[model samples]
Target: MTAPEWIELQLQLPREQCELAEELLLALEASSVTLEDGADQPLLEPAIGERPLWDLVIVKGLFAGDVATAPIEAALAAELPRAPLQQRWVPLDNRDWSQEWKRYFEPIQCGQRLWICPSWMAPPQPDAVNLILDPGLAFGTGSHPTTHLCLRWLEQLPLTGATVIDYGCGSGILGIAALLLGAERVIAVDNDPLALTATADNADNNQIAPERIATYLPEHLPADSGADIVLANILAEPLIQLADTLVALLKPRGQLCLSGLLDSQLEAVTRPYQRAVAFQPPAIEQGWVQIAGTLRG
Candidate 1:
């Protein structure tokens, strides 16, 4: 059978004008809008209650195959700061999007002993420490370089009977991996309640006992709680901002692993904790940095 057609109107615009262009596209009845980095640039995460964009962004508006383009372009020209610096129309094949993601997200091995596998697929190596993950829009399927970096770190650690905290526990990926690799306890914490739910559900999916892993909103985690390891796979700014909070969760000489920052931001992110923690050299993958350290006894 032939696939239904679709139109992608792609425009390159400055960061300041990207939001306006997106609004204009939606106003023009585009089905969906996507924004991408136009120039190879350092990436930053959105701060709470704030939106950040690349210096140069490529915005693509998807429309029905038969939608008229001339009127949309006219509208953009009138409403935007200026005409898009570059523009083009690309043909698209409409497919069953529900199953489309499955094609690309197969089993991924982060280290010799660990694999992140979707629940529906067989593990690439059954005897390996396989994490059965079915992400529900929270985050962390091990595809992001930051997640991969963390997963590898978890795999190599001596986690038996360790108490671990997964701060910013998106989809509970890191925490669950810790449990599967033999950690005795994990405290999974996140600001988003949905993330906590995903974390709890994922832990259950892995056949973890309800008592083995605890999920919490940041405010609800006990102040006295301490762990042998704390993994914070959140962005750079949050890592810096939460330096004191993260440190307080560690036992004496406990390990602290952090990722989700670019290589350039490592020094700044580490400065807040450097005085008390002896950090190992950072692990780099795809330009993302992961730093692990031990709290001084």
Candidate 2:
């Protein structure tokens, strides 16, 4: 399909006003927004410290006409801390994004031995242990810091003949990595149907028989079932809420790796896991954090 012409509007709002900005952005997301790039391109700004401002990107088509733009502008002007200091509209033309996007992805090495390479990317030397992954919308392309950190931890952790459960298994990268690392069996769970399908496809790509890895929604897993390793790379709130249930999925002395969090959010989620697991300083990359811990007596 040909790419759509896009107008990129960059908005800078005060830090306290970011909430309103985010809400507005979500409203736009809910609507059918058009961007020069595919929907895969995220609009959220990279995490900035407690800065007093936030940058938001809104595609033009979503708010093209005067009627759409006026309401958004008026809403921001009314609810925002103050008038946005900056608002610029940049025109974007659709290009062959597939090739352009691939340029940003390459072989990613985790730990000393583990390597994650895109299927189209040349494999690393045979001597180096490699995990081949095909990038898709579902997440865990190994480019994300959290996924990289988890892959590194997986390399260091003992996985031979172990049962591993990947909670919120986006793209099934982590669980598949465990399988390639010698885990006997892997169970990948995700709430999204697309993620489940992607995970299954990725497993097949990695030569994992359907039986070797089981994919299910969280609601489908048996209550009593537990795993030797539990990995969750989801947001802070859900992580905290699922702490008891997640921990219960771990066998005594099992280990867990938690990501999709900021360093500041570490306490809220790790605190609950403290009863069964000892927390470790988070692994950080690109300003994102992933915490790890081992289940204790």
For lDDT, the strongest prediction is 1
CA error at residue 40 for candidate 1, angstroms? 13
Look at candidate 1 and give me any clashing residue pairs. none
- Supply the global lDDT for candidate 2: 0.75
**Candidate 1 stretches greater than 4 Å from native:** 1-97
List runs of model 2 lying over 4 Å from the truth: 1-98
Candidate 2 clash figure, as a count: 1
lDDT of 2 by residue, 1-297 (tens): 533444445565444555566666556542232223212344453532112222343332233322345556666677766675566554446543224457777898888878888887777766777778877778788887878878988999878999999998989999999998899998899888898999999989889978889988889987777899999988888889999889889898888899888877777878888888998877887767888888887
* Number of the top-ranking candidate, with TM-score as the measure: 1
lDDT of each: 0.89, 0.75
* Model 2 weakest lDDT span, ten residues long: 30-39
lDDT of 1: 0.89
- Report lDDT (Cα) of residue 116, candidate 1: 93
Model 2: per-residue Cα lDDT at residue 240: 90
Candidate 1 lDDT over 199-282, as tens digits, reads 999989999998999998999999899999999999889999999999999999999999989888999999999987899999
